[model samples]
Target: MSTERRTKVLEVLKTAEVGASLLVKGWVRTKRQNKNVAFIALNDGSTINNLQLVADPNQIAEELLKLVTTGACIAAKGDIVASQGSGQSVEMHVKELEILGEADPEKYPLQPKKHSLEFLREIAYLRPRTNTFGAVYRIRHAMIFAVHKFFNDKEFLNIHTPIITASDAEGAGETFRVTSLDMDNLPKNEEGAIDYKQDFFDKETNLTVSGQLEGELAAMALGQIYTFGPTFRAENSNTTRHLAEFWMIEPEMAFFDADDNADLAEEMLQYLVQYALDNCQDDLKFLHDREVEENKNKKESERPELYLIDRLKFVVDNKFERVTYTDAIDILRNSKPNKKKKFKYLIDAWGADLQSEHERYLVEKHFKKPVILSDYPKDIKAFYMRQNDDGKTVAAMDILFPGIGEIIGGSQREERLDKLEQRMDEMGVPKEELWWYLDTRKFGSAPHSGYGLGFERMILFVTGMTNIRDVIPFPRTPGNAEF
Candidate 1:
């Protein structure tokens, strides 16, 4: 049969019509045999839920029955029939089953019980067989599609930025240096500095932390542009939120300011949430139900109280709260929690960068929703951000979700040539290296704004998955790049 002729297990089960001839192929999830009847759960990676397959021992040969083990790939020709079982609404009555591949039940790591996320990470290949990982990855895929759709529908140009770059855009100095050299036989200059002439690129290059710089160049010409690709950072952060490699979505628009940038970020976030909720309800429910079941086994006080469904529903239903950085600082300083002084970092000053803990409190406790904090101190922000009237702060905004601290960070770019030059000089950025960038301002400078949304972070937020490793297919963290 042609590929299109094959029926998806989900489609067959969801339709609920009886006596329809169908051909289904998938890895067998489970198999249970009675005297004459056998039931099997089959999954095709099309959805989180599996399809039920009922086979009669009398009709099918005993040879085929022995081969239908858990994790085995099978192609079954069956009749789509209404299921009388309470577990599912529909099932397939198998006429003949052909085993395409066999999996040794003993070697198969996945069982019909709950497994710790840490344990699952060790066997990344087989982890998707479980319900939670499957749903998370599927939702991740759907969210990617939704993002492309959201931007494409608005006529935003999709720009591809280079993974390897020569300059540090953020200036935080967290970058994975790329080199091709024999460390044992190194070349050095007269001053004992590493010789760049012997390096592959003739100079030091590192993985990009953010695509905003290249994205800005494209936006200047294209009017509206966005970059969606992998970004790397060398920060040795072992926290749940930090990852050495992650995907970032940066959208830049010309003739836009900080407020316009905030509106776009909020709209994009809500759109993705609504899209996933609408398109992947089953997958979301599967993850939710699995989490609830897992949580129930723990002590009442120890159990996770927040519901994924409720959190996502709230995100889609409510308007994101907006506040200036000054306002956020005031609120955090005067709050009862701040008075007790339990947080690690101080939130007493306006110019101080808001730590992750402070951001959590503002979004989770004070706003009770996604909060957009804008207008940050210029010294703490990137050099590209437009300087505000006060000269001390820049027009930068960070959208902090309740569970995920900072989902998006963006700002309005400084367009004035003299101010840009001065900022670069003050930051010690190389003037010769950024000649092309300076020329963009000379040609036709327009006020432009953009933001970078951490893609994996969004998945973590939507799925309520705690670790950054859980959201990505293969996570790359510090000293954990094993494939």
Candidate 2:
């Protein structure tokens, strides 16, 4: 006969009374035995804390108790009772136990002690069992749920954007071309160019770099829309911030301007931070303690509480810093002495793209908090950004954090037909391809704005994980796609 399964460990802990007959199935984290009793720490991936199981040696049999080892999957029929021990508030008194799967302790890599993050990445399949990653991913899941809820409550339409497109959104020339024909044998045109007509799509196509353009179209028709999906970039730079394939959330509003866009982004971020803090308190606390322990061996002067829990608390309690690009440049110029010399790209120029180091310095050193840098030079920004009054800059914004530099990039789109055409022509954008997009302005258009939030970058910021590869499952980077 099949045994009965009552409730999860999280649900069991929520109960007030004990002595409830229940069945628990989970991997054994730690097991210790005396002459007549054995203590087993069981984890069901329900939460950070494990359930304590007290098994009677005489009733369960010594052979069954001996079979229990670290990482072994087991099921126990037990009655919960108030614990008299020092570890937990409640413990399970096992009446019958059965071994579902046995894991050899000699081969199991995980132990009760700490393991390096680098070491854990090598065993990616098993890293979820650890405390830090478990907490990080749990928060990630919760954040995703909160995002859907926020959009749903606001009456925003969820638009499903295409993953493959023929046009480039960022126009950065970093795109992964999609093809089916073998590279070794290809048809050549009269100019000795490879014939793309023989490709799978019968023409050139590529993985989309951003869903902002499509999202904008939907927003114009549906009023407000958002797209949350995977975006790909083929750039080869190996940095803590860059990922070849990452998730991006792009929300577009049809009748909003630059200030409205900023307000929406700020509200969304605050809501997400608060949601994580409230829903995953235990997981956040677990990550906080793990971060503290990891910093114990390092120099005390260099260590700080940069983990998820602390960062969430700080964001929830304080206001985010906001400054225009011109003022930001002035601040960076005045604070040049504190800037690292190894950063070769940031020169405090008027029309230069801000590097990660410069962004970090602005948030961490100058502001000591998250900052929104807005009104960037139009020449340096994308073609879609609305032109400012000065005609030299665009109404664009980037939200920067202390640990993670640029977590978000957004802009007020250019809705004027003539001005947008001029900008597109000057930027050498193929006007023929974007004729439909340009016609949207001719038919009916209003000032609109949106932004793209890098989902992995946000996770990295919250978890204090240094590398972008760690936060993403099955990361695809330059020359690396190992599952």
Candidate 3:
């Protein structure tokens, strides 16, 4: 390794130390020239802003200057001086330059132009070099860091659950099988059926849909824990809000009821939003401007009411409206959407499973604030949820954002062995498959609650991004898994 300490472009642009000798290496974002000098915009993936380098014809070799172009990697030894241009604070007056790598202009895909998001998705590998994706990914990193920081500050231990398991956690039967067996010639049993016993794990296994079950086991002992990792699902729907693979943040807390779970979820989300506001200002500002530009083509009624920053502040500064599922149903039933037959699924009575449209109307139109709907019907919720005394509802809660429906979903788990086993039987979850999970309640269980916040959905809301795919770095949707 070379001992030469190189200054990153972000530090140079941010500090703007005048007359300081600096060696900066980065990819050229844009290049412009005049008869007297050449200006190169360089980025090192440190920030959304680029550092400008001014090269004079007389000081630099003519041939070297000719080789500098967009997408080329270069090293510039220069003096950091105040820029003489607009839209930037500092620039480098280069005394020496070297072209580390040359990108052929003819073959380079990401030229300096206005490329559509669809076009950018086709080139996901190179999309990070663009201004929009750079800002998005930077904000994504900030949010991810904020998640661990918030949980740690709250004394929640981070847990890494197994990615492959023999039992499905979500119990939705939507899982990707994880097998290392030969596909062409599978092993057969005495019944002449494909034998999963010959697989790597010696039993049927799949990618985890959620880490909630394992998280609960840890929480029962650790008091509180959280999981932040990749989660997989086999759902085939190709919608803006769906992803075949994604990252999830699930925090489980022992000795906590449904109310406490809702409070923690609200606080954590507010903290994350505030963290982004403080740490990711430049990137968020860029995405905010990008959102404004993209919203131009949208119909007036479909556009967001507030700017990105204001919307974020609104969530952080206000109290989330907490109401029961029954109350929310009443609100939605009397709302104009239901009366006008505008909702795709009309709310006819209690115990009806709420869809995204209904959730949006409750949070955005009726309440005009973030809403936490709780005490959902047990039939619509998971079998692990604690059944209420009413015999029809469960101690579950879903926090819905204005634009994004159900940003967080969780419940106070059933801690009673008899009740849990009965519900599992009712839900068709085989008791034999989850013997270890049932052992928790059988041995030493306490009231526990947790919720899952889809990491990409939070990023989408924070960045004012319309599509969920835009927030995640190589989105995995149906029939599209390109890198």
Candidate 4:
């Protein structure tokens, strides 16, 4: 192998200087051989597109060329040339080839053929090598960068919140506990209950379900802060929308109210959509076509109203319709679905929690655009949400999208210690557990607002992928944690 830098397939495809010596190394996607010539498609995760390598069997050993099958890794010294092929504009004329690794054709799970998403999930370690998942992951990475960039550009401090904490941010009681105690011989207190005091942290702790509480504390000091990290949920849900471990992007602004929070969330969503359209077109296009092919055979009623690229552009170009939860309830109650009993969870009352079907109907049918549903009932929302003048609803908002409902959920916080403590008591949440969180409200609390954007959900929208498991790599789900 040459001691020179390797040119990525992405760069190789864009090379203007033809006949330049280039060293490219990647796993072979496909290889076709004739009696005199052999062609190899190589990719190194630099791009979804592959670098076409042309080799002469007369020059390279037959045995060496035979090893360059599908899933084989190889290093090649070649010269970039204008391709005579129809698809790619340029190709590499390989002069020397080195087989770094070989995949036995008989044993390799993946071949040059189509595989179901379920089958691919079984072998997720190699799924990135596929066109569909490679595109998904590439877009995933672009969004990860875009997330940090969007926050950094707005001067929001990126805080690394603890994964393990003593408090459940959501107070839902569904949390994966983190303990260093023997189960067989558990320690007990005087009351004969399992004593958490003897645990590793000297108290009961679990994987954090959200970082918004701690993020709120930082926002109180830093003015604006965001936490982008993995959040866990112990709910045993195996649905398409849920995961045991997923990522969250929570951004808190100190001096912002409910309206300001909604505005910022809207701007961020538009910005992310625009960024993906501008920067990740190639990968997005691949996913777009893949989505199209996947949905083409389905009934017309079941297909998406707009394609992936079109929907992304629509989000960037249009303003989200802002509506109060009360008004939304009135609309839903009077809607045809509710009247005809089409909805599984009928919208009968004002305090009813809006289901995914209702949210989708509002965005896809009623609004015909993205929406910001605000002023949720106080009891339905978290204890931290600011109570409105009605005393029944909180200043909570949920941003609903076309295909996905409730892409983001945020609200203006209850800065007043009295109100917050009262709500905490009403919800039976022990204030003593989150002493640090309460300290922020007691000392220097401001009218802060924040929202959480599910990272995988964002990817689902951008990639037009139906299942949340496919967007995230190594999905942690109930009864499954396979690679």
Candidate 5:
């Protein structure tokens, strides 16, 4: 309870002078007590490593020491001393111990044992106390910081886009509707249609699917802007890749073409990977080992080609392979997988949309590195992508990684008002609803481009976690939102 500033376990482990008295407050990860002495491993979630506190059984009361079990919070003041331990270099000699919170040993689900990820999700509230989730969350924080740092270093302004909006930017037709009207007896017009005008926004509104459209408006004025925020989709997918809600990183820039956009994306991703290697060494090592252990039992063909750390470094050290969609289609069509009838959806046609199998094969087998497949056919892409001179393909690009199909999706936006309207009409994109967006092209639209990176998917790639749910703190999936 002293007024002196508390010392973190990370600081003490990294740089603490021996014989200096300090205080550390954290939950007791494990405690071993014999008649002679007790060794308590305390963690405050500051780092992946825990600080070992050596306490004399006589000095610290039995009542106090007994409560310092796993899942119990404790504050200890002690003197720093050199450790004879294997993993850690320093340990604390505890002079004072206080229990801030106590977890009943009978009811506490987390113990000094391994629990499957499925079991952990059942108790998501206490899952963070586990070693695996702890490392995951720490890396999650690191990625968040690096995202802002990456944009800020490029002099890109961070914009807070609205969470609630009326536009279905992706036109996915699946959204969580926000309303204050009575559902039992809803307001209906003369045509017996539910009148959304009586709702909160006086129009049909739902959680936004993408911030790129609004980010463009700001880019037209601010030159360059980025939005890193939560986005929602109401699809009924229950795969490892689908989430009802997730975070997205969307950056819009003026005077940048599709090539410039691809270059920036590659640089940004590599920078983040290098940043993690430099800063989060301990946590990365833990997750890397975790991945190795997870893949040990699988078939060789199903196993990852490289270790987690090697995979990350390979991505940073090598340049991504750039290939056109037409070229990629040719390769896939003539490749052994398609020829041997191994592909789930065989690459039989040129204009057909590429599935996850096709994308992963291109990255993992065909290129043996990250690949940027560009100039997709206009019919398959969104309406905002710029139409090419050939009139069949758009200036679109998708960055594909080994395990994941497409990590980043973006395009050089259709800046011409006439061309944009024509695409909108062809796709039946309700141009009247996006009149303000049309105004952007009518007034002062410059050659601009942007992309959206799924924050969790990248984290999945970075942490080498298989399930998309594990990377996020509390996953919002189809039927599960429990915390």
Candidate 6:
């Protein structure tokens, strides 16, 4: 055995130096044998590319070669040489082979065959070894790095908001309660209700649905802050777009208004898209080709207008179309979808909330680019949103993209205490529960705006993948929470 330190397949493949002896260790992706030699495709999760290992049958013992099945882990010492094959540029001539672990051919679920995405989801533990998932996750990581890098470049401080919060920011009342008290025998007060005062936090608490509330507090003190963390929602939605537990990227700026917020969101998204196009070219190409093949089975009308890279380039090159909710409603009402009654929820009036179908129509058909719809009706938005001059609308914006509707949602916050309290009362949100939130407005609050981007939704859009579950490592949905 060579005493040299092991090298990752990516590192070895990128080296221009040849004829150097080295050790490469990874899981077997595929093993094929010809009359005189065996070729083993090895992957170390470093990159989508696998290093080809050539082993002469006379050199490698038969018992050792028998253990080199798919999913088996092995270490090989070899000399780097130029490959004659067209798929890759380099190959390893193995002089020493060691089987670290053996996988039973019949028992290993990930055989050398194309498995459906649904089947891969069933075995998520092993799905990362697959090409589709490998590329997806690498691209996911690249996007995550790009997000932090983007905000860092803008002098934004990264803040960690509380996962457990006492107040609901969105007022949707969809939360998963966190309790240490026994469920069978709960504490009660004289009112004959469960006494939340006896719970873990001395009051009721639940996994936060959004970090925007706390993020605002941080921004008020820090001037500019961004939060990237896990958020939970108790809404039992089992759709391709919804996840019970997922990640959110929220950024709050102290002096930004509604328009400033929209501009920042658009710039950040375009930057990330451009970053992915530059940094994750190989992985994106793999996913793009995969999506193209998958789309072949779909109806002609249901197919994507542009391929993945082209779609991303479209976003990077063009500016997002901006429109008011009223104007959007006018456009939608006069559009063909509404006239033909094709939308599931028809856009009939100004106050009606726009559905996914409506947003897609505006983004994909009307604008042919990203669309930012602002000034939604106040009653349809949260209590904290700043009321517009008209009193019927709030300074809220939702960024809609071609494949995904509302990838981002944000708004200018109510800075005046009285107006905020009045809206809180009108919405039936207890003011006492959010005393800390109101204190910011009472003392030193300024005009602030923020927006939240669902991290998985962004991944889905970038990867051209349709399902949110596939983007996340382990998805927590309505009825499924398996590893």
Provide the TM-score for each candidate, comma-separated.
Answer: 0.95, 0.94, 0.97, 0.97, 0.97, 0.97
Q: Is candidate 1 or candidate 5 better by lDDT?
A: 5
Residue pairs clashing in model 2 are none
| Clash pairs for candidate 3 | none
What's the true lDDT of residue 254 in model 4? 95
Question: What lDDT tens digits, residue by residue, belong to model 4 across residues 1-483?
Answer: 846788888888865478798899999999988997899999998888998999999998888998998999999997889889898888888899999999999999998999999999999899989999989998999999999999999999999999999876567449998999998999999999999999999988999999998899889989999999999999988787788999999999999999999999999999999999999899999988888998989999998888999999988989999999999999999999989999999998889998989998999999999999999989888898999988899999999887777789999999999999999999988888778888888897789999999999999999998899999989999888766
Better of 5 and 6 by lDDT: 6
lDDT of each: 0.88, 0.84, 0.90, 0.91, 0.91, 0.92
Residue 340, candidate 2: Cα error in Å is 10
Q: Please write out the lDDT profile of model 6 over residues 1-483, one tens digit for every residue.
A: 435689999899888358988899999999999769999999999989899999998999999999999999999998999998898888999999999889998999998988988999999999999988998999999999999999999999999999988776567549998999999999899999999889988888899899999999999999999999999989978789999999999999999999999999999999999999999888899988988998899999988889999999989999999999999999999999899998888877779988888888998889999999999999999999999999899999999888878899999999999999999999998888889999999899799999999999999989988899999999999889897
Q: Which stretches of candidate 1 lie over 4 Å from their true place?
A: 1-5, 187-192, 297-306
lDDT, candidate 5, equals 0.91
lDDT of 5 by residue, 317-415 (tens): 999999999999999999998999999999988899998888888898889999999999999999999999998999999999888778899999999
Count of clashing pairs, candidate 2: 0
Query: Residue 343 in candidate 5 has what lDDT?
Result: 92
Which stretches of candidate 2 lie above 4 Å from their native place?
Answer: 1-3, 189-192, 305-308, 336-349
Please report the TM-score between candidate 5 and the true structure. Answer: 0.97
Query: How do the residues 222-254 of candidate 3 rate in per-residue lDDT, one tens digit apiece?
Result: 999999999998999788888999999999999
Model 6: weakest 10-residue lDDT segment is 164-173
Candidate 3, residue 32: lDDT: 91
Least well predicted 10-residue stretch by lDDT in candidate 5: 164-173
